[model samples]
Target: MRTRFAPSPTGPLHLGHAYSVLLAHDMAQAAGGTFLLRIEDIDQSRARPEWEALIYEDLRWLGLDWEAPVMRQSERLPAYRAALETLWSRGLLYPCSCTRRDIQDAVSAPQEGAEPSVGPDGLVYPGTCRPEAPPQGPMPDRAVLRLDMARALSVLDAPLRHEETGRGPGGETGQIAIPGDSLLRAAGDVVLARRDMGTSYHLSVVVDDAEQRVSHVVRGEDLFEATPIHVLLQRLLGFTSPIYHHHRLIRDAAGKRLAKRDDARAIRTYRDEGLTPADIRAKVGL
Candidate 1:
């Protein structure tokens, strides 16, 4: 029942973030399980020290308590490198040199009702790097590393399953079992590591969660689609799968999901405007 709230220090925490943190903390507390916090500051270009400091202050002001000495991903580059090396040795990874335009052109050119599979960031790569021979030598400049989706699927001996218990957007509590095919098709050949930062979200998150021995992952439902990719990576990397709970997202009056760019919804702005933690909780209907 252990759960964690891993936040990146790219921007100020927002109402959307508060919902996720409070949800994870509440679930852990109710089950008498440990609560942990991990700083997902892998995007060095965008991550800032001041933003990270604000994360701590905001979460503390919310009356949330996490295990001391928080885990920081910036300090764990070696671990991610080890994972990339393992995947490379197994031939599960290939270096990609295609830019965004190249991928879009491939996807748009006569695919016949091909419904694109969106990643967590909402981009569906069109497998431009799925070549017959794996590239040799050092990775290409500005090259990205993509997982061999077809090969990964072949190794999956059986369908994976995860149980989730929560109220749907309609407000009915129920359980659902996720199927393997649905996950595999939607998570087609996701990027494991990118040359820009040397690692992508999928690779770093799965590795960190396993290293921390997280028992449960509770977050916004938008990420539910990416769970299968994480699960597949876990199986490949020899890590145990943690239970998942994808809760509802906190949206604005226009029904759009709140983001860091929504300065009006930023947690710090709310705090400055004299909004209490209880006020945030009630606003999000948590």
Candidate 2:
């Protein structure tokens, strides 16, 4: 059993982060498994050296330790590009030139009481820039790459499903089978690589999890809707899907999800207020 706490070094570690990292550490310790830390600094535009240092300080202050030689995403562009090349060779990926405004305008409705459908990744892409057929030459540069979901599913033989060791926000559990059409509707032509960043979260995460040999994935429940996207990518890439454990989210008094911008609930702020590790565990009901 292997688990990881992959946090982006773009902001302070908050109560929600504390609950997640502590839970992952405790779970690994109980099972006598290895606990790993990976810094998700892929968005280098906002990632900072100071924030990365503070992540280490906060985790240590929370009475937790992880294996050395932590992985950082910024250093793995070649791996991501390699995966994209594989998908591109199979005609499962294509370059998309649609901007967010273009997608919204295409999918938006003019009639009253009708709003554009929203999917896991904001507005569902309307395939405005999707080519009628796969390109003949090499993959293009400086353009967003999107997966051809219909073509991808058509190439698969077996049914796509994953084990759920933890509950979802909607009580979805057990072996969840994902239908091809459902994925097409829910996450239509999801981006595999962005213009600025070579790889999107969906592509990078599944690759990293498989490379790390992670048997279980522990994360917030809000990401539950995106699990099928990862599962499909795993299938397309010939990787096994890990047991997903989506835990309850730590929210504020108004029942809103905690944001990284909310510094009042940051772990460093609590530490400055003289709170102990035990106090944090109790506060998060761990």
The candidate that wins on TM-score is 2
Query: Would you estimate the TM-scores of all the predictions?
Result: 0.90, 0.97
Writing each residue's lDDT as its tens digit, candidate 1 over 202-255 gives: 999999999889998888887776776888889889898887778888889999
Question: Worst 10-residue stretch by lDDT in candidate 1?
Answer: 167-176
lDDT of 1 at 276: 92
lDDT score, candidate 1, position 189: 71
Report the C-alpha lDDT of model 2 over 1-286, residue by residue, as the tens digit. 8999999999999999999998888888999998989999888899999999999999999989998889999999999998999999999998887878788778875747676667789998877777788877898886799998888999999988889878887898899888888888888899999999899899999899998888889999899889999999998898989899989999999998998999999999999999999999998999
Deviation from native of the Cα of residue 91 in model 2, angstroms: 0.2
